[model samples]
Target chain A: MRVLGIDPGLTRCGVGVVDVEPNRTAKLVDVVVLRSPADLDTPNRLVRIADGLEAIIDEHRPQAVALERVFARSDVSTIMGTAQISGVAMLLAARRRLPVALHTPSEVKAAITGYGRADKAQVGAMVARILGLEAVPKPADAADALALAICHAWRTGGVAGAAVTDASAPAPLARTTTPAQQAWLAAERSAAVSGAARRLKK
Target chain B: MRVLGIDPGLTRCGVGVVDVEPNRTAKLVDVVVLRSPADLDTPNRLVRIADGLEAIIDEHRPQAVALERVFARSDVSTIMGTAQISGVAMLLAARRRLPVALHTPSEVKAAITGYGRADKAQVGAMVARILGLEAVPKPADAADALALAICHAWRTGGVAGAAVTDASAPAPLARTTTPAQQAWLAAERSAAVSGAARRLKK
Candidate 1:
């Protein structure tokens, strides 16, 4: 199966596609970086990234899409840009009906280098070796994308768990809940939101 | 001019459209809340939101889109969901070539209630009065969306600064920089990202 992995960001988004076999071996199919200059307005920058992903999807046609999960920023400043990019990436995958997975930074490191705490160089070298590349991918972000794809492939074994990954793809979210249970949960959320909004008014 | 204002959240996204006359009198056009269950998987919930926003835009045919600017969450957990929803809303506006604005909560409060730190009830009540409604919109989130639209209309004086906002719309994030300076700043960002990525791997 083929997987497209995205390390999403506002100024720079790293994307890589990989082909994985049942034996768990993975090969890098393609790698590219999507960058929107900081001077660009937010909407246009997001559009550029979304458009870039569309081109990649059309070109590689990966069976699944994976992304680096959004993490908290050290400051309040960087959160929106990261989340916006992450949101756009998920939307793109859903639009194409492709399954999506989100891996934490440590998840990528652990999958690629066998250590969740591995530094960037260690992860890069491991990703290079696993993909049978002569050198680590240029631009560490791109290598990180490759690491994410490899991680998703190794963790899910590709193809089989894709439906679970894409909550929009007719798979159960929690797997254990019945439709009735889900309906109850929905009602609970509605009540909670209304309650929260009401309380805030006081 | 008509404005579609979005109060973005993963659990409940509030959207409202309003018409602003030349004299700055505003009339309500439409209001609705798009809700996703907590039990729903993330991607599917996002798709539900993106689809809902698309329908709202097509139906209302608003000339501009506005939303509450992403703010730092006290709890941290809510930031990604809010930012992602915000991103999708902006992407929808960009796709349709509509101008978009982001109003801070305090700005909305100030616009509607004559006080920057006014509570939600005060803003909602003022929104009803401004739009000439008998009562505030049902479901506080929807009221909040209207407040956002009203804020944008009042602050930018409707269609006059739209071209500026939209240019800032397609491109800007920080919302404070001029275009030329933003471009130079973007170059600096490019250098910084490359530098940061390189250093991480070393």
Candidate 2:
């Protein structure tokens, strides 16, 4: 199966394609990026992003779409902007009826490098080395998008796990629970965030 | 001066190095990744991360360090773990007195790709193309961490703005000011987040 990973941005969104082999191996196929103007209105920007996503999907024909999950930032505008971008991505994938999976940025790093803290160059090198390529991926976001796809492939057992160094690492996160569970968990997070925000306000 | 970018995880931490010439051009030098045992406890896991960071710094001797800033996660456990890893990165950089800059994932992505919404593969491709490399960087996290360093170089005008694209296409984000101004406005983001949290609670 071919998987497409997206790093959605309002101005500059990244797209990467990885083909997963029957033996559970993934190889990089292509990466495309476009930068939108900063001055566009929000709806216009989303349209631009949707256009980019459509172009990528048309070109790559990926069977599945994997996205990096949203993490809360201290900046409201940044967080809102990211959510809007993410929403666009989800809408695009859902429109195509493609199965979508979300991975945290840390999960992607950990899955690719066996180190959650690995940097971009390290991830590029690992991707290159894993595929026995001549060099690492460029334009870091492209590489990250690829990594997200790869991580999904690995998670789904579509790729060989032995090559991933942290195959035995404890699950970095809990398994998928019910919406109720998720809500409860999120409530705790909301409380923590609120507490921190209140403290920062002072 | 060479700057090493690190993405820290309990089991795997990605590392990447780029030589930032006096002229502000960043050339990829090396990327390394280390994997720790999956079952190690919190303290031991931190030690593993610390050791890996030290080793990378010693081998690369980077003049500075750049990392993706931690954001709040709904999972308290995950957030705490991320903070711990961040602390480990900070400690290693501090030991060497290397100036460390923390960037949000979007900032790093924006710096590397023209759009903050750019995906991982696009970022990787950009990294490769900008650095004049032939292939996408591997293990994606390494590439992203490295991108953070590259973004810093670009933002500091080290590359004379060569690192970022000027696509000027309509972006999904609605920014009223230039990115430089947007960056300066981040200080107020904390307050905005706090207010949003309050509104969400009601």
Candidate 3:
């Protein structure tokens, strides 16, 4: 499944697209940082960002969108703009009939770096390593967007697989699983184990 | 000049339209509150509000939009939704090539009532009186929306007239005003004075 991730803002909005496989591997499709001038009024700035997002969604045609949920920060001024752009992003996704999932910053960091308190550099490094890129995506927001996409894909059970895997708890068995689904889950578990081993080795 | 005023929210968005003349008289064009169900997801709720706002703008064809500016409040949860809807309103206005102006709650209140910190009932009473309505618009948001429209119209000078008038200082002479513009400004000043006198009598 192709997932589009967005780190929304007024001045700079980062967008990344990735395809996740049933075995829990992710490949980068595209990444971009859309920007609007600071001197422009809020309305025009919103329009520019909205247009950029629309173009990206049309070009990639991602099945789902993963957005960075905005929180009210100490910086009251910037938070409003962040929330505004996020709204625009969500509206665009709804217009195209794509499902949207919002992931908090800490959630994205923990998913990518195994620590919710990890710094930007650690998350960026992990994102680069996961996508097998030679260098981390620039501007921090770009790497964050990619991490959001990977996190959503993994949390939702790889491409089309079912049931979230909790490290501390056994899988719930209320619903029956087909043989094909079981096999896919097994493959996913193995892949996760091997991926952790490789990271430990590095 | 026709102005559409919006009190944006995810659950209930208030919209009001009015036409203001050169003499600062405002006539109600239309007023309504758009609502989305609380059970709906954030994305769909946003879509519903956007559609409602778009339809109103298309139908009214207002020359300017006056949206209530959202502020960070003690209630953090509601602020995000307010900011989001405000963004949508601004975007809609921009798409139609109409100028959008954001007025704070105090600004709207002060514009309608003489006191900046006037309570809701006071502002509502003033809005009804200004528009010559029989009663205050129901659901405070509706009256607030009309207040926003009247405020914008008055602040910008009635029906596309001249520079902003200051109660504390003389009008800036930076730009030359035509004879017709001067006449409009004089009429606006007299209307403001008479309006204040009427309110004082009440």
Fraction of true contacts retained by every candidate, in order, equals 0.72, 0.00, 0.67
lDDT per residue as tens, model 1, A60-145: 99888888877677865466787898899998888888888877887677556655677787777777877999998878889999
lDDT ranking, high to low: 3, 1, 2
Model 1, CA-based lDDT: 0.76
Q: In candidate 3, residue B4 scores what lDDT?
A: 91
How do the residues A42-148 of candidate 2 rate in per-residue lDDT, one tens digit apiece? 44455566678888888888887777776667764455455556545654555565666667787776666655676677777666765667866677777778888
In candidate 3, which residue ranges exceed 4 Å CA deviation? A159-202, B159-202
Candidate with the larger TM-score of 1 and 3 = 3
- Per-model TM-score, in order, reads 0.81, 0.42, 0.84
Q: How far out, in Å, is residue A140 in model 2?
A: 1.4
Model 1 lDDT tens row, B1-202: 8888899999889999998876668999999999988777677789999999999899889888888877777765567788889999888898888877777787676556655676777767778877999988978999999988876765555653353343224332345444654464455345433553234334
Clashes of 3: 0
B26-134, model 2: which lDDT tens digit per residue? Answer: 7988876666665643444555666677887888787667766656567634554555465456545654556666566787766665556767877777677657788
- Clash pairs detected, candidate 3: none
Docking class of 1: acceptable
In the predicted model 1, the residue pairs found to clash are A40-B171, A41-B171, A41-B172, A42-B171, A42-B172, A44-B170
Write the number of the candidate with greater lDDT, choosing between 2 and 3: 3
* The candidate that achieves the highest DockQ relative to the unseen native structure: 3
